[model samples]
Target chain A: MSATAVLRVDNLESYYGPIQAIRGVSLEVREGQLVTVLGANGAGKTTLLKTISGVMDPEKGTVKLEGTEIQGNEPDRIVARGMVHVPEGREIFPLLTVAENIAMGAYTRSDKAAINADEEMVYSYFPILKERMTQAAGTLSGGQQQMLAIGRGLMAKPHIMLLDEPSLGLSPLLTEEIFDIIRRLNTEQHVTMMLVEQNAAVALDVATYGYVMELGRIVMADEAATLAASKDVQEFYLGISQDENQRGQRRWKQRKTWR
Target chain B: MDFVQLIVSGLANGCVYGLIALGFVLIYKATEAVNFAQGDFMMIGAFVCLGLTNADFMGLNFWLAVPLAMVIMAALGYLFDWGVLRHMFGQSQVSIVILTIALGFILRFAAGTIWSHEPVSLETPFAGQDLRFGGVVLGIDEIAIIVVTVVLTGSLFVFFSKTKLGVAMQAASQNQLAAYYMGIPVKRIQSLVWALSGAVAAVAGILFASKGAIDPSSGLLGIKAFAAAAIGGFGSLPGALVGGLIIGLVEPLSARFAPDGFAGIARIAPYAILLIVLIFRPGGIFSQTQKKKV
Candidate 1:
């Protein structure tokens, strides 16, 4: 990890009306690192990403991108500052053509030559998109739409990306393919990422660091390999218990530790 | 020849309605609110042009007056959204509809107060002139209306497809939240859409005034245009024009040719078409049914 963090969230708090969705969450992603937040449904994973990207304003806390405080800024402004969010469910512009969808990702940019080059680069990552450039995005199959979503995010030339469940609704083969592209984007392009996922096992494989959250709180944090090897994580998250006879007892013990 | 003339005149009138309907579609696509004040916006445009060109007021040339009116109307549209409509964002669809209806009444009342409820004609160089195509006769004003509609609609089509800002506006219209995440200023785009709609309404106003007299009630024609929009597919631009033409043709045709008591049906011709369209194809002719995925 780099000495300086590219992105950081400090004492963050967010809510959906009266219900607090994220509670005093703090985390950092150093430059060129792939960090993953592994949590179950209702674990505030999506809320944290939404707050950082300015989709939903945090009630309390600060988000810093390269040391600039950007909390409560408009989502577009946050995107302009080199951070983009590929939201859960892959919110691709259904009515727009695949090419037009990618063009919109560069809405804040004006350099025509660079934008064209970036677009071609996106095509290289997903050649299928090049074939379907004129087709409406809504017509795409689920995996293809996911690729288009990520491609749209890359069109912004983001320094750090916040990906929320990229593997959602994908077959196992497609999920592995998507994760491979994510890994390549991190390693080859040197793009920093903060990924939120329910697929903890696959996420841990690509992530350099990981955090485990439950019900709006981080229960454990460690290096990805260390966390993956932890007995608590193996039993509960990875769904692997070595002692089958005491599996129920171990599950109870893990719950007690997390609480 | 009389029938042909009626067809020509109806088409010109339909072009005017189509222009107003286009404005409604533009605003609705961006914000999803069917602005009831659209017709009143047209009324304001006509009144503004009249005020500028009348000898008693600014007395500007027809050329200068029309553009000035459009600019003022555009500003008014921006203010309407920035000051009033923006606050209504995320409200229930019913409340927003009611709010726009209330806004329509306010605009009509304001226009009546300012213009004194008197009907006035807009003077243009082409007024009272006619062109003869063998047995078929077309008014110079009618020709101007057709030409302007074609040019404006064509430019708009190109603009949306070819320009960056235009594409951004379309993207914002399609999915505001997704566009926002891509660094497009969605709120600003909404304001811009309103302004553009206002400018188009101004054109419709000027064109209508060129044909005949205009008063505060002239904005009521916007209701016909709204019907036109509904007939075309509320969000489709080309659909607005086709729907307007259909309404335009049906009205005069029914009035002139209908037997006995059926003559009154001309007044409700546009609404009649709307009902038929709603019954047959609720999405309108041009609208694609959207399917939400889980």
Candidate 2:
């Protein structure tokens, strides 16, 4: 899976009505690498994901996927190009059956056999979906619906997935389960992922590289281990004490300033 | 009782109303926009059937002509998407609703110009016969209307529940943005929904025409159907039917038993019922309210 960058956002500016949500934010995702975008509420994490997935068109910068500019492309076209965005709220079709919701994820794929294989793979990851295949999606518990949302994205056969807040309203155990599945997706399938999450601790743990965003700007960007060690991050962001065996527990006493 | 016969007649009328209401419900479920043109689509269907079997255009048998008319209406629905609806896609809800009303006016005007505004009968296979069951007698044309409505509703239920395309449409209706991300051809599905609505409207029109005469003003029939939708639950299929039946039964009962102007009151009954239901349960009798995650 080693190759040049699969997705690159250069100086992107995005807007929601008159308000600028993302101002000159630039990021990159390399092949098979897990990159995490950590930010607080209203820091434009969702806007960034929307822009990269072509839901919100960039006001200033270019979003290049596989070396082609795709900043202003329609969502379906961007999806067909193999970048799937599992949106912030697990927006599974409430009225649709579980099997129908999964089938929709393969709307662009031409190969029926491959889609079936992917469906099987998704069912393997969340076997509960198989039990509830014909049941209405609205009937599922929140955690199960989140699993279905992820499974639906996988149906796209994405080269890279942009996930927004996968652990929003779940218990600690369910959150861990979600992060584990994400980690396995990255390691086993070698699928590139750009995760935007408020769960900074789990995100930092799993990510190869991390970016801390504040007020729609990237405040810090470094290897996950180094950023996790910074005193500034611990005080302002990752406040909880890191346990032993955690990769990014060592801290610098001195607070770091932005470059 | 002779009163029982009138009640039976009202029930049959309500069934037709239910069919039209189902079209409203189907389109509303798909788009969340009330199609004011739905009744016009019904009128178009009957006129098309009239034309096809009139010995002037193909002159086909009633059964053959019926399916052909539905097909033609479906095609017009596709054209409606390409012509008027496509422009209003993703616009505000009020704008879409207004656009469809404008389309309804256009359709009514066109039908008037081509066929004239006079009442016209569309001959059917069982046009003049009546069947007696016990003391109650049912006209063959009325029975045919009921049968057509039931058959079309069943087919639509199957189409939405069983087919791959149907499931996709349901997915799109629930959350269009998510459906788009999933790679469903969201635009095509919307168009298909419009087409399906048109087909259903045509069937309703044919049934209406079977009983008596239809004219351009017949498009006003959608108002009753809209009332039915409001009664049954605005976006529910079963609700639409139930609502329609309620309205249908009330008019005759009210006219027969109540004061002279009670028929008008009966006409307003569904809305009054809708208001009462809305006060108590905003989500309607059978429908569930959607929950939003923060």
Candidate 3:
């Protein structure tokens, strides 16, 4: 990873009406780095990604994409600026054919040849999509839909991608398959990524750096290897309590100390 | 031969109703709003074309005036979206329906004030001309309506399938937030849809006026068009055309062939068929149930 940060969020705060969802959060992903944010449900993981993608406005923050402030920009404009967001729930256009759905991701681009080449490149990643290219996206299986959503994001030719829960609603085998692609995309294609996930073990395995969030705040931030080896993470997140009988008890103890 | 003549004329009238119903379907598909003002839009088209072709007014010939009126109506549609409908985003469906109804009344009053309540004929070169084939007679005006409807329907089918802007509109209709994230301007597409619907309304109005005299009350014909939409499936384009034809065939066939007391059935025939179809398929004949994944 380089010293230059591709994406930087500073003192970001967000809310749903009066209740705050993200509070004073700050993070950075350097050039060509894969950073994973690990948090359980309601930890503000999704909210943070939403804020960064301009889907939700932050109460107070500055989101800089390549050192340019992009906070409060329209979502379409944010997409056109080369930052693609694969939102949670794999919200692919259900009624459109797979080809058309992917085409929509390239809506900001005017180069016809480059767009076609990128589409062929996506088909190389997932051959099944090519077979079902003309089929409605809603008919695809869960794993295929996730691949379509990510493929759609890749079609944008983005500098950085903000992915929210790629492992959601998938089997362990499918999750591993997706992580392998994510890892390859980062290492081989050199695509910068900020992934939000609940599956910490797989997330840490692929990411070079990681952040742990709890109750809308960053509880820990460190190198992925170091964080993976930590006793606190092994016990709470990795579910490897030292004492088998004390599994439930250790989580309660860790939560208090971490807060 | 008389029966074939009735079928021919009925199909022609049905084409006009289908065109008006298409305005309802287009707006409903794009914005999920039942625009009650669609009939008034048709009324305005006829009145504007009349004014433009009158010797004392713009004084343009019929051929030139019709297209001009269509252009003006399209602009009015865009203005309606920019000035009124745009602000009503995120409102409840029932409220939007009621708002459109209120708008319909306002447009009707405005039309009445501008053109008065008296009925008038819209003059066309082919208005009184007729063509004979063996024992059957066909009005040239009726043939013109059929031809225009076919051309308009075919063009729309091509537009939605072949054009990028049209596909973008379809994507936006399916999921606004998703389309927005994909860099499509959703609000602008909605406004464009309104404009397209208005242009279609103008063509339908012009065709209807060419058939006979039109009054302020002619806008009531939109009710039957709504029934056509309901029977054909409210969201499907081809469904609107087919539904309109069915309603057209039923009314005339019932009135000419029914016994003495049953002659009154012609007025309620369209609604009665709508009711029966809804009882079996609430989504209309052409609509499919949408499935959402949890």
* Residue range A54-86, candidate 3, lDDT tens digits: 888999989999999999998888888999998
Give DockQ per model, in order: 0.73, 0.56, 0.65
Cα distance off (Å), candidate 3, residue A244: 5.5
Regions of model 2 farther than 4 Å from truth:
A240-256, B1-8, B56-61, B89-91, B132-136, B256-282
CA-lDDT, candidates in order:
0.90, 0.85, 0.89
**Best-fitting candidate, scored by DockQ:** 1
Native contacts retained, all candidates in order: 0.67, 0.62, 0.48
Ordered list by TM-score, greatest first: 1, 3, 2
Docking class of 2: medium
- Candidate 2 Cα lDDT to native: 0.85
Query: What shift in Å separates residue A76 of candidate 2 from its native position after superposition?
Result: 1.9
Q: Across residues A139-178, which tens digit of lDDT does each residue of candidate 1 receive?
A: 8999999999999999999999999999999999999999
Residue range with the least summed lDDT across 10 consecutive positions in model 3 chain B: B285-294
lDDT string for model 1 (B1-294, tens) is 999989888998999999999999999999988988899899889889989997777789989998999999999999888998789877898998898888888888898898778888888779999999898888999999999999999999998999988989988988887888898999989998999999999999999999999988888898899999999999999999999889888888989998998889899877988999999999887875556443
10 residues in a row with least lDDT, candidate 3 chain A: A243-252
* Interface RMSD against the true structure, candidate 3: 1.2
Error of 2 at B177 (Å): 2.8
